[model samples]
Target: MNEREVLSNYVYQIVASLVASGVEQVVVSPGSRSTPLAYAFASTKELTLHRQVDERAAGFYALGLAKATAKPVVLLCTSGTAGANYYPAIVEAKYARVPLIVLTADRPHELREVGAPQTINQVRLYGENVKWSAEFPIPDEAPQTLPYIERHTVRAVTIATTAPFGPVHLNIPFREPLVIDFKTQLQRVSFVKSFTNDLTPSKQTLAEFTSIIEQTKNGIIIVGELPLGTDTKALWNFVRELKWPVMIESLSNLRTEVPEDCQVFAITTYDALMKNERFKRNVRPQTVIRFGAQPISKFLMQFIAQSNPLHYIVIDEDPMFRDSTHSSTHFIHALPGEWLSEIEISHVETELAYIEFWKTADLLAADAIAKYGQTANDEGAYVQLMLESLHEGTDIFVSSSMPIRDIDTFLPVLNNDIQVFANRGTNGIDGVTSTALGFSNGRANRKTYLLIGDLAFLHDANAFVASRYQDCDLTVIVLNNDGGGIFSYLPQAKVEAHYEELFGTPTALAFEQVATMYDMEYVKVTSKEQFLATITSEKQQSLKLIEVFTNREENVKEHRALWTRINEVIEQWLDML
Candidate 1:
């Protein structure tokens, strides 16, 4: 076979293997070295190709697709800094455990150490961020080469979608002749498929856990960030049976559409109440059962430390130690769904005083917060309005930093089925827009909403250039606080000398101009009624942006005063204990 035929078969076999392994969608960024793969992907009818210009946005776009589908989505980019642009998304996919197959085309071995243009050390570039990385052999006619290509492609998909799914890398090197022959169809070879078996706990394990539950009366369950589309029926039944004080994180997808009876035990206001010196000192859990990752609240983390449960159990199917407190006494390596569905539970007879106390404190804190969020014209107030305005079965993607923190504190348990998503893996603010846009492609995307900070919006505007959202009914609500609003709450705010120049680095850009540049309908919400009306109104455009301007200083003061008020209310309640 000639060079053209060799490259054609290699690329075609790789694409077929990806399909065989269950990659339904692939996002591609045009580049010279990746032309062969792009053509192969575009030519195949089994795969869907999304052409994007910016590699950074393209990377995050793939991440969002993987998240929405709960399957492995392939990402293809050229060598050099283009692949490096994918680093942030790769890191997020690592922590978030989204399965992404990154295929980066690189220069051949001859170009290395010669400082070739558009070339860098492409081998294992993502480092520890990926679960596994493989460097493909150059296109050749060696008998073993084709088999290796076929098996490795399937293997990459298996590793990516296996237990604790995450990103995987495949660096393909191509020489000057990057084009493929169009005369003959590329060879599509067959490969083996991969499957992941569910891990269920044994009867002895279940009995032991039951004993732990029966012995302890004041146990608590902490549900953190769960995977998207996790069937929570089993989890809900477990929570219902336990009737423990469950702290539901914003991304857990547990609080949305929860039963009113279950919501009584859900202490969503713990972030506000945990800050109280007396509450933290007095309230304690004798046993703690944690599921998923750690919650995004530092105050809650501190409270967990203060609570200091003696019989703590963390559950996961992988080797990861999900307990950040390092105080957990047991780790169960079983899938949450599998064990939660199979476990047998019989409630132990005890007084309902422990959970009753939490129910009262939670009500007081929630009342105080609702009053503050009523008409304060603060960011939290805007967020509260936005959360309430979302329709049932809608998807809301929140950005990190202040946006997520606000959602965590201000959002109350709702009966509507509103799914919440965030990039809290690394908690970076870089690709909030692209991830949301990517998520907006699958089911129920026509009513997708994004609650983002102003800086995150400006930083990721490149995602709009080549994005072709299928339904495109995306409503972006930007909290335009000018600069980093979260920084004002930290101790660094006291360093007023360089705070404005350094931390308070405001970008005074008229977002209306940005809306004009992107051809999106722009509306600046001024009053509380106007903001609520704008978000709840009919959707006429493909993409509409609503910017609510706020003050950095005032937001800090507003958040503190609300917390103080909550503390006062909770303190009064805790005095009886």
Candidate 2:
């Protein structure tokens, strides 16, 4: 093979190997330093190449893809600070436990900071944010670095997809010999799965967990955000025997027929239980049996920290906590499904007062929501609309801040088959759209629904420019309340003049204009009924931009009104007691 052919083949070999190893999505940023890597990925018909111009956006785009697919998505970029641009997303992925495989091409070590353009320290530049970082040093003149390149690529891909997966960086230093022809390159291929093996709980651990469950009849199960394809059946099997109140979070894909005896919305009932004596007695579980990753609400975390149940046991693959409070009585370091599979856990025959009491509270809350939460006046209403409209088994991605909070608070995720994801690790608003679009490329059959705010949508409009979301069943709902809608609900809004100018800098631009610029099908809806009827239709192949018109000022007013009413009810109940 000639130099150009060798280069092209090498790129082909690396991307093909990644595809063979189970990485279906590759997000590439247009850059010269990494032209070989980018070209190889783009030419491959087996792997889906998502082109995002901005390196930072591309990084998060890869993160979103990985989050939705539960597989590592590769990110390719040229040398210099292009790799550095991925740090924010790196931190977000690290905290969210999503896998990101970053492939950055660099100049040979000879160019060592000697006043070279776009040359900064690319080695370990992201610091501690990434789970693993390695460098593949290929000589510019030597043509026999193929074996080393193949080995490192395979190893890097493997580690990135392992359990507790996060971002892994493979900084490749390409010498002149690296820039070879694609057609004449030799292909050394391996079909190894780049994924973590399921770790089952030991017999001893299962018995220990069963003992804890048997000791307390009034136990509560708190399910958090589970990755896609997680075995919810194993968890349901164990929970069924307990006859306990299994509390499902918005993201937890716990869709096996929930036991009739279980309380569906236990996390939201924390405030009422704390204030009402009768309700507390009836609703408080003797033990809290927690499973899955971190729940989204701060209220739930604070409640767990303060309430401190009689026996708290967490079943998960990673022992790390996602919240500020860190106190667990026991943590079973195994997949919840695997742990439950081993234990012959029998259901407790004791009466569940907590489940019965919370059932009534859940009913009351649901009724209230049904009655008063139907308009496009609040963020919660947007969530309710999307949840009611989106297709079953749709992959929903929510941005950080109010978008995720609204979904967590109101979206009634009844199907375990449908996947839901959010950038919750660091909870920043950056790259929400890019990540969602990147994630959609990996799904062959499933459609992706990305619900974002106008500010976030505008911030990552570059994502739309790249045509990555085109032809995918990708629907982006921009809840255009205009300029930082969440700020109106925050304390800053208390000062009207300062709030309107600084915090709530409402942009007057229409949402349709954005869709027009991106050449997407745009639909504007002002009412809940219209949104529900329109979104549920079975349609695929084009990007649909649904712009929901909402007023930030009105949204804040409704939120405060609800909080006031809830607080008043709490005070009245307390006074009566």
Worst 10 residues of 2 by lDDT: 265-274
Q: Which portions of model 2 show Cα errors greater than 4 Å?
A: 1-13, 43-45, 140-144, 177-179, 189-197, 255-282, 346-350, 374-376, 413-418, 468-472, 495-497, 529-541, 563-577
Highest lDDT model number: 1
How many backbone clashes does every candidate have?
Answer: 0, 16
- Candidate 2 lDDT, 1-577, residue by residue in tens: 4556656656666776777677777888878788777767766677777777788888887787787678878888888888888888888888777888888888878886897777888888778888788887653225656556666777777776666677888887765644544454337675454455676776787787778777786777788877545767677766656766656766675532343433343334343234344455445556777777767666566666766777777766665644356767787776656556556656564464556656555555444455456443566776776766665667888887778767665654254356667777777888888778777766757878888888888888777765744444578988888789988767787777777678777778676776787777878888877777668765443788988888887877876565555545554554664
What tens-digit string does per-residue lDDT give for candidate 1 at 1-577? 8889888888898987888888899999999989989889988888888777889998898888888889899999988999999999999999988999999999999998798999999899999999999999999989899889889999999999887889999999988688887554545666655656776777888889888988887888988987644677778888888888899988898778678778778889988888888766656888888888889988887777767787888877567857677778887776678467566666664349888878888899988987886647789888888887778888889999899999998888887888789998889999889888888874443468899988888889877865453344578899898998989988999887899889888988758877887778889987788898888888667789998998887888888889888888887776766
Q: Each candidate's TM vs. the true structure? A: 0.95, 0.88
